[model samples]
Target: MLMKATVSGSDVKTGGIALHNLQKRYGNAIAVDDVSLSISPGEFISLLGPSGSGKTTSLMMIAGFETPDSGQILLDGKDITRLPPHRRELGVIFQNYALFPHMTVAENVAYPLRMRRMAKVEVEKRVGHILDQVHLGALASRYPHQMSGGQQQRVAIARALVFDPPVLLLDEPLGALDKKLREHLRNEIKTLHKEVGKTMIYVTHDQDEALSMSDRVAVMHEGRIRQVSAPKDIYRRPADLFVAGFVGEVNLVPVKLKSGTVHGPASENLPAPEWQEADRDATLCVRPEHLHLKTSPPGSSGGLQGRISGMTFVGDATIFQFRSETGLELLSKVLNVLPETMPGVGDPCVASWAANDATILTE
Candidate 1:
């Protein structure tokens, strides 16, 4: 069991990190471009995106690890863009544990405290307290080699928190762990954040991790943030095509807006409700999970026909890849337990998705 709640004040009582017109360019190649965001104190914000999308670069700027070509980084309304990383007073846990192999877990966790020239008794007390907090008290005397990857990561986290820094920065901290272990640690990390109540900036390319752990996620793309919102909002209503495609599996269908109604690729095949007048050139974004696979009632409105191209069972649901009669590729997700027989490959299937499930986007 973990330690019960303690009424220690906010870890980063200094209002949190802010970036204004942040830009980083490496010889004409823009790494992070004109990004402005403010992370609130005690909030866990994740920079999420695919590789080379500027998520890590932005996090590095926040951590004072990377120099921005232009812009201001403010911590608690005070500029810290030119400050050295150590003077920023933030805790950081890197991808590679970065623990000395020769050092015991206790020693590793105590190093930060020792650097501050803290008293021996105080260091021991704090180290012991944090070891217990990370559930590594039993292995305190063991070296990194003697511990599992997960255990070593716990030690790294304990070390980061040992100094009680105002903010925490995690850069792909769970990337080295296996899927199940990673998922387990994800929850543990969130719980730790709540327990510590420290402002955290997490960087990762994994959408699931970002969606599950963040208070708010900023989706980066091509060196700029595409969208920043809560997980459900980001998934359900993405701001643009990039976000819709990046956040999850989505099918993009070419749509033409005529008379305020969106027509499918097979124009006028499906009757859709009239859309707003401003929806011209809109593309429909539909998630596989929202598509319903069923037999078509004769001439049912807003229904389309497709043939099952492939089906894959994925634990809780079956994914159906359908090739529409209109030559469009689509997918549907059906719950595993339902008796509604899944259409086999090459079988004719009627696929229908709610008009509301599809998001209309231009460009």
Candidate 2:
């Protein structure tokens, strides 16, 4: 039941963004190294990484707050590498709401329009329209100090959208809120994106946030992007060890390739990558959910023979820790549909998975 908000003049267009060999350095340390990416118009892309991984630095460069040592930033095919922040006409939302303490919600939402020398009537109209779009029309007279963190964030979003910029840049805008509020606001932001049809670039260290909201995710590590793809691809077919381990809960099993087969402490005669070199050491990455546990006799099933060492019951799933006969530890996650059918600790079990469910990492 949400209404689409419109701005005066035509809607913003051509929001595509391209980065070419972007690099930044501080002292002898490199922050962003040879980072290059292309974002399509109206696409929601998330720059995901841990702290000190240059995600924030990269966003800063795009926002014109920091200058890259070497690179070009093209917005809608126009180079804006050296353009000032204001001239770029990009909307930016920070971790903090950044609303004026003394100004009411209506006043804060009208700030950007007023800065552009917009007329009083037009500014008021735009502010009212945007406030309603964000479900804050009733709170127009509330000040920043009088609102909750989530409300303040919505005001920030409303202020940014009041001008209808072509691209929106969010730097962990929900990082200041609680877990439940963050989840709620992220969905709201996603809905807002669809309604506005503006290109959005969100930067965050939280994997769930990136996987849940982004149309595509660019995973950065050690000052460079390790992989860029859809959320499912990034989670299921990780490019490297860093990506597989960082994106989710994965069990790394060291294995050796002999001929066209793989040999490990708990598994043997496993399928090996066709492109991998023979007699090389590799690691098999498998998610806990992909591993199925059976109470079959050891060596009876073609999988790792292990004993259930421990189990932890989460809300919707139970995590079982398995200790292989070779002393290797592995984890299996199973849904908690029927507790009576669940295996107990100290039960002998075999953990197995299909070949396609595992990714072999050579590095």
Candidate 3:
């Protein structure tokens, strides 16, 4: 039982961290561009992208591990760009569980407090309290080697959070765990985030993890932030073609806006899009779930006539791969409802979507 309901009225309030025009370069390659971002107090933000996207670089710059070629880092209105990692009031958990193998869980968690010259009584109290919080009170005496991956992860979290630092930076903390353990601990992290209300910055390459866990997600690509918004917004209204294709399963078909109408994979013309000055070099962006699959194409209407080339059962939903007369392939997702309503392979289907449900993305 995770004791989340009983946790409230934190002794230490969270502090926000800000990155102003942060830039990083490694020789000739630019690692991070001029990116300015702000994190709210007690807000949980995730920096999400593929490898070498500058998510880790931004986190390291804030953690004082990497010096920004330019720009400043501020902690609750105070400049901390030059502050040493040890001197900054920050808690960090790395991808690998960095626990002392020789030390017991209690000792490991108590190390930070001890280094800060906290009283022995206070350290013991804090260690005990935090161990119970992470449901590790029973394993307090266990060594890192004796614990499972999940257990060791909890120990690392307790150690980082025991001192109740204002800002917590987690760099791929769940990357080492298996899918099941990653999911289980991810929920615990969310519950813990809610229980403690601390400002957290998580770095991950997992889209589902970031979308499900973060209050706001910053999507990075090639050392630049493509977009930062709520998970739903980022998924639905991506800032560009990269974000639309990256975050979730999307069907992108070449679309042309001619005169007052838009034409794409669907058989008919669509209403003009409300966007910037006369830019038709665009693609239609639609999620699989938004596609409405029917037995036949709606004639004279803007619907796609296709064949169900493939069908996949994904527990909660069934995914269908479709191909149109133009040889354009697309995907549509339908929930696992009654068996009678499910479409199967070789079935003729028409995929149509609402005009507002799709977004027009340039480049």
TM-scores of the candidates are 0.92, 0.94, 0.92
How well does candidate 3 match the true structure in TM-score terms? 0.92
Those runs of model 2 whose alpha carbons end farther than 4 Å from true positions after fitting are: 1-13, 271-276
TM-score head-to-head 2 vs 3, winner? 2
Extract clashing residue pairs from model 1.
260-275
- Residue range 53-148, candidate 2, lDDT tens digits: 999999999999999999888887788899999999999999987899999999999999999999999999999999999999999998999999
Q: Which candidate leads the pack in TM-score?
A: 2
Instruction: Write one digit per residue (lDDT tens) for candidate 3, span 1-363.
Output: 000011112222348777777799999999998877778889999999999999999999899999999988888777789989998879999999789989999999999999999999999999999999999999889899999999998999899999999989999999998999999999999999998888999999999899999999999988888888889898998889889889999998787776546676443664335654353657888899988788864343347777899988899998889987678899998887678897778887877888778888766
Residue by residue across 260-346, what tens digits does model 1's lDDT show? 777787775443444766437777888899887775544554566667888888899888898877899988877774645656688
Q: lDDT of each prediction vs. the true structure?
A: 0.84, 0.88, 0.85
Candidate 2, run of 10 with poorest lDDT: 1-10
Clashes of each: 1, 0, 0
Candidate 1 whole-model C-alpha lDDT, 0 to 1: 0.84
lDDT: which is higher, 1 or 2? Answer: 2
Question: Which number leads on lDDT?
Answer: 2
Q: Model 1: which ten-residue window has the lowest total lDDT?
A: 1-10
Candidate 3 ranges beyond 4 A from true positions: 1-14, 265-267, 271-279, 297-302
Task: Give the runs in model 1 whose Cα sits over 4 Å from its true position.
Answer: 1-15, 269-274, 297-301, 337-340
